[model samples]
Target chain A: EDQVTQSPEALRLQEGESSSLNCSYTVSGLRGLFWYRQDPGKGPEFLFTLYSAGEEKEKERLKATLTKKESFLHITAPKPEDSATYLCAVQGMGKTSYDKVIFGPGTSLSVIP
Target chain B: GAGVSQSPSNKVTEKGKDVELRCDPISGHTALYWYRQSLGQGLEFLIYFQGNSAPDKSGLPSDRFSAERTGGSVSTLTIQRTQQEDSAVYLCASSQRGVRGSNQPQHFGDGTRLSIL
Candidate 1:
C-alpha cells in the first residue's frame, strides 16, 4: 500500500526559531513528492515538487528536500504569518493522469511572536 | 488565468437529502480530482477523472457517491442520502496531468463546506 506519514504532528516555535517537518513514504514507484501549505478555511497552496532523491527547492523562507524514502520541509526563522499546516503528498507510478496522490495528516505549526 | 473554482462555497442540507457539488477546472487542465477533508482524517481522495474516464473510484466511501465530467472541463460530484458523517469540506483540484514524471502540481479551490443536519 502507498502511504505518507508526517512526524511531529504539531510544533510551536518562537518568531525567529527555525525547524523542519518530515514526511516519509512507501510507494510502489514514486513519480513526485509534493509540499503544500494550507491556512485555515482555505485549500492547500502548492509549494514544491521533488521528483527524485537529493532534490531540493526553496521559496521565501521555506526549503524542501527529498530522499528516496522521505522528504523534509525546513522553515527558516518563521514568523506568525508563516504559521500554517504543512502537507506532504506523493504521486505514485501510473498511466492514469488522475490517479489521486495520497496526503499526510499534515504538520501544524504555530509561530509565537 | 484563474485557478480551479468550485460553486456554493457552503451547503447545509438535511439527512437523506441529495446534494450536488460542482468544480470548474483550469481552462486547459485535462485532469480533475475530488477529495474530502475532515477534522482528523486528513484529505481523503474521493474520485479522479482524466479527460472523461474515471479509472479509479476506489476511494469513494460508499455507493451513494458518484461523479462525472462533461466536455472535459466541468465536473460534478453527487452524494445521495447524505448522512451526518458526510459533512466535510469537498475540495476540487486541477492539474496538468499529461506531463509525465514531473510538473503535475494540483491547484486547489476554496472548496465547498458541506453540513448535513
Candidate 2:
C-alpha cells in the first residue's frame, strides 16, 4: 500500500533556530511529492512540489528536498510567524492510487521568541 | 479570482440529524475533491469529481455519505444520521486538471467545521 509518514510529531524551537522535518513514503511509483503549511483553524496552503529524487524547491526561509525514499523540509532561521503544521503528501502512479494524494499526519512546529 | 469557497464556516448539531455541506470550486477548475480532517489527524480523502461526475467514492467512510456536483461548478456533500464520529473539518479543493500525474496542484478552501453533539 502507498503510505506517507512524518516524524517529530511536535517540535519546539526557539526563534531563529533551524530545524528539519522529515517525510518518508512507500509507494508503488511516485508521480509527485508535495509540501504544505497549515495554520490553526484553516486549511493547508501549498508550498512546493518535487517530482523526482535529487530535486529541490525553496520559498523564503523554507526549502524542500526529495529522495527516493523520503523528503525533507528544512527551515532556516524560522520566525514566530513561521510556526505552523507542515504537511507532506505523495501521489502514486499506480491504478489504485493515481487519482489522490496520500497525506502524512503532519509535524507541528512551534517557534517561540 | 476566488479560490475555493465553502458555506457555513461552522456547524453545530445533534446526532442523527442530516447535514449538507457545499463547495464552489475555482471558476475554471474542472476537477474537485472533498476531504475530512479530524482533530490531530491527517486530511482524509472523501471524494473526487471530474466536472459533474464522481469517478471515485471509495474514500467515503460509510453509505450514509454522498456527494454530487451540479453544472460542473458547485458540489454538495450530504451526510445522513450523523454521528459524533462524523464531526471534523470538511475541506474542499480544486485543481486545473485531473489529478492523475497532471502536475496540477490543488487549491483549498478554509473549510467548514462540523461539530456533532
Candidate 3:
C-alpha cells in the first residue's frame, strides 16, 4: 500500500531558529511530491511540487527537497506568521484511471518570537 | 470564480439528518476533488471528478457518502444519515485536468466545517 509518514508530529521553535520537517513515503511509481501549508480553519495552500530526486524548490523562508524515499521541508528563520501545519503528499501512478494522492499526517510547527 | 469555492462555511445539524455541500471549481478546470479532514489528520480522499464523471469513488468511506458534478463546473457532496463520526471539514479542490503524469497541482478552497450533533 502507498503510505506517507511525517516526523516530529509537533515542533516549537523560537523565531529565527531554522529546522527541518521530514516526510517519508513508500509508493508505486512516484509521479510527484507536493508540499502545502494549512492554517486552522483553512484549506491547504499549495507550496512546491517535487517531481524527481535531487529536485528542490523555494519560496520565501521555506525550501522543499526530495529524494527517492523521502522529502524534507526546511524552514529557515521562521516567523510567528509562518506557524501552520505543513502537509506532504505523494501522487503516484496507480491502476485507477486517475492518479491518487496520499498525504502524510502533517507536522504542526509553531514559531515563537 | 477566481478560485475554487465551497458553500456552507459551517453546518451544525442533528444526527441522522442529511447535508449537502457544494463546490464551484475554477473556470476551465476539468478536474474536481472532494476530501474530508478530521481533527489533526491529513486529507482523506472521498471522490475525484474528471470533467463530469467520477472515475474514482473507492475512497468514500461508506455508501452513505455520494457526490456528483454538473455542467463540469459545479459539484455537490451529499451525506445521508449523518453520524457523529461524520463530523469533519469537507474540502474541495481543482486542477487543470486529470491527465496522467501531469504537473498540475490542485488549488483548494476554504472548506466547509460539518458538525453532526
Candidate 4:
C-alpha cells in the first residue's frame, strides 16, 4: 500500500528560527513529490516539486530536498508570514492500480514574532 | 487569469438532504479533480476526470457519492442522503494535462465548506 506520513504534526517556532519538516512515503514507481503551503480559509499554494532522489529546490527562505524514501522541507529564518500548514504529496505512476497523489496529514507551523 | 473555482463557499444542510457541489476548472485545462478534506486530515481524492476519458471514481467512499464532468470543462459532485460524516471541505483542482510524465501540477480552489446538521 502506498502511504505518506508527515512528522511533527504541530510546531511552534520563534521568529527567525530555522527548522525542518519531514515527509516519508512508500509507493511504487514514484513520479513526483510536491510541497504546498496552505493558509487559513484559503486553498493550498504550490511551493515546489521534486522529481527524483537527490533533487533539491528552493524559493526565498524555503528549501526542499528529496531522498529515496522521504523528503524534507527546510525553513531558514522563517518569519511570521511563513506560518502555515505545509502539505506533502506524492504522485505515483499507476491509476488503474492505485489512486493519484497521496497526501500527508500536513504539518502546521506557527512562527511567533 | 483565473484559477480553479468552486461554488457556494459554505453550505449548511440537514441530514438526508442531497447536495451538489460544482467545480469550474481553469480555461483550457484538460484534467480536473475533486477531493475532500476533513478536520486535521489530508486531502482525500474523490474523483478525477481527464479530457474525454472515463473518470476514475475509485476513491469515492460510498455508493452515494457520484460526480460528472460536463463538456469537459465543469464538474459536479453529488452526494445522496447526506450524512453527518459527509461534512467536509470539498476542494477542486485542475491540471494542464493528465499524462503521468507531464509533471503538471494541480492548482486548487478556495473550496466549499459543507456542514451537515
Per prediction, the TM-score for chain B is 0.92, 0.93, 0.93, 0.95
The list of candidate 3 runs beyond 4 A from truth reads: B98-100
DockQ of 4: 0.63
- iRMS of each prediction in angstroms? 2.0, 1.2, 1.4, 1.8
What is candidate 2's lDDT per residue for A2-101, written digit by digit as tens? 8999999999999999999999999888888999999999889999989899999999999999999999999999999999999999888788645678
Task: Write the residue-wise lDDT of candidate 3 on A16-105 in tens digits.
Answer: 999999999998878899999999999899999898999999999999999999999999999999999999998887766346777899
Ordered from best to worst lDDT, the candidate numbers read 2, 3, 4, 1
User: Candidate 1 on A2-52: residue-level lDDT in tens?
Assistant: 899998899999999999999999987898899999999999999999999
Candidate 2 global CA lDDT score: 0.91
Query: On a 0 to 100 scale, what is the lDDT of residue B53 in model 2?
Result: 51
Native contact recovery (fnat) for each candidate is 0.83, 0.61, 0.67, 0.53
What residue runs in model 4 are displaced by over 4 Å at the alpha carbon? Answer: A95-99, B98-100
What DockQ class does candidate 3 belong to? medium
* DockQ-based ranking: 2, 3, 1, 4
Better of 1 and 4 by lDDT: 4
Docking class of 1: medium
**Once superposed on the true structure, which residue ranges of model 1 sit more than 4 Å away at CA?**
A94-98, B101-103
> Model 4: per-residue lDDT, tens digit, A6-56?
989999999999999999999887888999999987788899988899999
